[model samples]
Target: MRRRGIDALTHRAVAEEAALPPQTVRAHLPTREDLWCAALQYTLTGWVRRGEEFIDRLPEPLTLEQAARAIVEVATVHPAEHADTTRATIAGVYERYIQSGRHPELRPLIGRYNVELTGLVARVLARHGRHVQPEIARAVLAVVDGTVVYRLAEGETPIPAAIRALEVAIPLLCPFPNDT
Candidate 1:
């Protein structure tokens, strides 16, 4: 349901997709909203896990550009593992969660996950020390996200372009003080 969108998914559809009885699906999920939320949470957990794993496998003290390149490479190489559409959907749901009066229970979980993602980016930027500020770190992330979205939409390869762009832009955006 989360992959396809809520408007197009029904309990029966999910049951059929899972090769299970509707009753069984109801027994586990109970409500369409619940199912959607669970699917989103599952996807979010997977994304975070995959990102952390990629970071872990890399050598320590990665430069800002290297960290950014590593992340984009990992994501592009494993599109199935980190679907761009799913990330966009999660972002939408997160926005809705903030506006909705109900579902206070979900806010903490979503907020924490968002913070985790931001902290990962911040850590990468920290390697550049005085060169990169919090705002610049955020802008870098936005650029990376936009690049990924464009690549996905166009069905074009982005790993090389993303790496090159970031490599060139990072130094300009956060130039060494002495060089200035």
Candidate 2:
């Protein structure tokens, strides 16, 4: 699924990729939609896990800049480690974004993802003994997402742009001082 889009997903192809029997793949996936759902969930789950791990590894009493950097890294660096993986992850993300618009069932999942992201930003703010309005947090997320989408589309590194924007906005959004 990471290597190809939903249309290319099939029990036989999955079995071939997994080096398992087609019957076993069918018994597990049952249908193309089921397979696609599982594959998408699997990718998201892995990404979330890595993100949690990255947050867990942060030093105690995180500074505002550190917290902001963490969020940026989780949103970008941790999801895509290599060129191919980066392309695949971007493809999956845009595909889901398009699918959510066309499929109402996915809107709830997308909403939940947004809520979780908001909570993450809130937690990061709290850890630094700072507070940002929900609107500001949402704006920060929008900046991050927009930067990432731009990077994926243009095949350019937009980290400097994102960091510069965050450096400028975070202090204004919260009471914390920019140590960097």
Best by lDDT: 2
Give the per-residue lDDT of model 2 (tens digit) for 51-88. 67767777868875677676675655342224344554
Candidate 1 residues lying further than 4 Å off, grouped into runs, are: 1-6, 63-65, 73-112, 126-134, 153-155, 174-180
TM-score of each: 0.65, 0.76
Error of 2 at 131 (Å): 3.4
lDDT of each: 0.59, 0.67
- Give the Cα error of residue 110 in candidate 2, in Å: 3.3
lDDT of 1: 0.59
Model 2 per-residue lDDT at 129: 69
Q: How far is candidate 2 from the true structure (C-alpha RMSD, Å)?
A: 3.9
How far residue 51's Cα lies from its native spot in candidate 2, in Å, is: 1.3
| Candidate 2, residue 180: how far the Cα is off, in Å | 21
